[model samples]
Target: MATNLDLQEQEQIDAVKAFWGQYGNLITWTVTLVLVAFAGWNGWNWWQRDQAAKASVMFDEMDQAVQAADADKAGRVFKDLKDRFGRTVYAQQAGLLAAKVQTDKGQADAAIASLTWVADEASDEDYRSLAHLRLAGLLLDKQDYDGALKQLDAVKSSEFAGLADDRRGDVLAAQGKPAEAVAAWKKGWDALSDKLDYRRIVEAKLTAAGAQPAASGAAQ
Candidate 1:
């Protein structure tokens, strides 16, 4: 019985060795890859958090500059944020805030530069739409009708479609294309949700432009 038991144990050991021989490298490689991926994920998360924290500090600095109404300082801090932490949310916020300061300070060129960066580089679609919309308005103020229309054309978010068409109408009107303006305004009015008071404002524009407004049930 002892000899029989020894033989059975040896057979079991040999079976395990055969299995290991066939799958050992695959198992080893899979485990090694899993560990490396886990480590890389953790490292990437840590790096992102570190970057955001530093970017937040710079954003705060830009905010202070904006509050002071110091366009120069805001622009400077925004440049630093763009250079060092441009991929962070704080950097996008800084660009928008600094642009606002620059606009208010009559620094149109600086405002345009900051807004252009946000329009081109903002990761969030909503932010990109916002930047493009604001940039359109700035271009309009400069009487760059073609540039304004181009920016409005670049707005991709459906959420901003009504606003974009409204701005497009404004640009067309400024360019002495009253008929085109009316058409654009009609689209804007049709796109806006009835719940929005701004929709009514667009409706008024349509009426004043001697165009009939599209009928819609009033928001309950």
Candidate 2:
């Protein structure tokens, strides 16, 4: 009985060894790939965190330059931010700040350049809309009516619908299209909530443009 048990144990050991010999390399390779992939994922996340931290510091420097009203310094720092971390939110915010300072310094071309970059390259839709709005204003100031309209056309977010309509009215009014301007202002007024004080301003615009607010349209 002891010899028979020993033989059975030896047979079990041989079966395990045979199975391992057939598939051992494949199992080893599969485990190696999984481990490498996990390590790579961890490394990528670590790299992004480090990149964001460094970008935040540079953004602060750009903000300080903007606060000082130093357009050149702000532009320089903004260039660094764009070159190194243009995909980051901090870089997009820095672009807006740098553009404002440039505008304040009478650098319309520089401001337009910065705004264009933000409009074209920002990943965030809200930032892109803001860039478009500001760019349209700048173009309108330069008497580029068509350019202003084109910028406004790119702003399609519902959150910015009211402002975009209002800006469209302004541009149309500047182009001497009173009828279109009034229509645009009516849309803007209707888009705003009744509780907002800004709704009153939109209503005033509509009144000035020979249009009645929806609430008063029936009375007229």
- TM-scores, all models, native as reference: 0.88, 0.82
Q: How do the residues 160-188 of candidate 1 rate in per-residue lDDT, one tens digit apiece?
A: 99999999999999999999999998888
**The candidate that achieves the highest TM-score relative to the unseen native structure:** 1
Candidate 1, superposed: residue stretches over 4 Å from native: 194-197, 212-220
Reference-based TM-score, model 1: 0.88
Positional deviation of residue 184's Cα in model 2 after best superposition, in angstroms: 1.7
State the lDDT of candidate 2 residue by residue for 111-143, as single tens digits: 999999999999999999999999999999999
* Cα lDDT computed for each candidate against the true fold: 0.92, 0.90
Model 2: residues with Cα > 4 Å off, grouped in runs: 1-30, 215-220
